[model samples]
Target: MKKRNKFFTKKNGFICAFLAPGILLFLVIYAYPLVNIFATSFCRWNYKNFQAPEFLGWGHLFDNYIKMFTLDANFKMALINTVKWVVLTMVIQIPFTLLVALVLAKKPRGWKFTRNMFIIPNIISTAAIGLIFLNIYNPSRGIITEICNKINPGSNVSVLADGNYAFWGVTFAFILFGGSSCLLLLTQIFSIDPGIYEAAKVDGASAWQIDRKIILPLMRPMIGTVSIMAANYGLLLYNEIALITGGGPDNATFSLSYYIYRTALGSTKLNFARGNTAGVIQFILGILLVGCINKAFRTDQGD
Candidate 1:
């Protein structure tokens, strides 16, 4: 029994060693900010209130969230935009990405060159993309305007300048941006047993049938991760929306993360506690959502 216990202990120690860097990374990069934000959210803080952070006992958090739910105009618009963004990304972006992945998986014409070129937009920074889009959406003599007017005389469709279009424009801004890699997801999807596909083909399955019945079900875990990633990215959205709309023609596109920045730095800058509250709220929501999605994915995979 002692020998067995010693062996198990050594194995557990080795496992923990492998996990240490990631655990420490989470602590330093994510956990500390979370704890700090949560604590700060419960207090009445100011620019110079760093020394003695007053504890307001959840009042600020609740009031801020209540304001988000009821009073705040920007919050409401942000919420609406967030929902739309999530839906569009999940319904359109993920499927589109998968389609691209599928095309790349097939050794089509110029496959190697095309795959490298297709993800080029992701290599460019979001700020650069935002600026590029801004130019493309400019009303007069811009690339988009020039092209549109050629098609229909005097057509001036300034997408980012208008409220309705701005929502969609921001949502689709990062549609091409992958996380600095040929999507780990694409690799995962491609790695799926080709034998199943061959078997399905032997059974006279159409391409659409293969995708619908086999690809989608097997790709559920990756899809779920991508969905959550889209939502979380949309929730924490800034930059492109800021550069494109800057909370918009009428605060029509203020996301939670952007609102936090505005609240912390705008005319209502004195409400540091409330700003912190928003950050803490975003943090909590992100954790809950990502955890739930990953859990669901695991359960689906287990089955």
Candidate 2:
């Protein structure tokens, strides 16, 4: 008994030794930053007071948040656009990726080649993708402008120069390119037991029936996962906007991430506390989104 206890003690000591570096890194890198951001959201910190944050009195603790909702037109627009993008991800990106994944799972002729081609966009950096779309939306030499002119003689279609057109241009730049999410769904689909498919076939299940009844139900958790990923991507969108529209013809495409950047560092009128408050809101929204998706998919319920 004593020997067993001594062995366990040594084993635990080794485990702690192995874990110590990671724990320390997490504290310094992630936890500390998170705590700092949350705490500083209630303080006054900006270019004027670069030394340290001054705490807003308890009565005015929520001044930044109140100003964001009540006075900051940019913040309101950014929040609205962010929510719309998140909704679009769920409505369009998720379904499109799932459809592509389902089609590829059947292993059609040249399906492997098709899958590789589809994933190519995902492999490319977002910066490169944004640049590519920027050229595509250019007024004079862009393919879109050329196509419009072909359809209607003398027509000049400038996507990035118009507010509504620019918002959608940013959306299309990144929305349908869900190759990574498709890959995750495909992996989940393939992991399903082969015997189940065989049995469904033997039971005279049509392909559509099998897909509707079996595949989709089993793919729910993975759908939830990919949904979270895509939604988060939408919520935190920045690169495409910066490259394609630069938040617009009239600030019509400002995402929360871009708003945070402009507020905190990019703009001359830096408001560190307000930016941090926005960060806190973004963090909370992310947590809520994950919870809602998990609950919708019943992921916590063991299969």
Model 1 per-residue lDDT tens digits across residues 159-256: 76778887777766776564423365567667899998999899899887888798778877777767677767766888888788788878888888
Candidate 1 residue 267 Cα shift, in angstroms, is 4.9
What's the lDDT for residue 127 in model 2? 95
- Local distance difference test values of all predictions, in order: 0.73, 0.90
Q: For candidate 1, which ten residues in a row score worst on lDDT? A: 176-185
- Write model 2 residue lDDT over 114-219, tens digit each, in one string: 8888899999899999999999999876899999998997879899888888889999999999988998999999999978878989989998888889999999
After superposition, the stretches of candidate 2 with alpha carbons farther than 4 Å from their true spots are 1-13, 199-204, 301-303
After superposing candidate 1, which stretches have Cα over 4 Å from the reference? 1-29, 47-53, 57-61, 176-182, 266-268, 295-303
- Candidate 1 clashing pairs, residues 3+ apart or interchain: none
- Residue 98, candidate 1: C-alpha displacement in angstroms: 1.3
How far out, in Å, is residue 148 in model 1?
Answer: 3.5
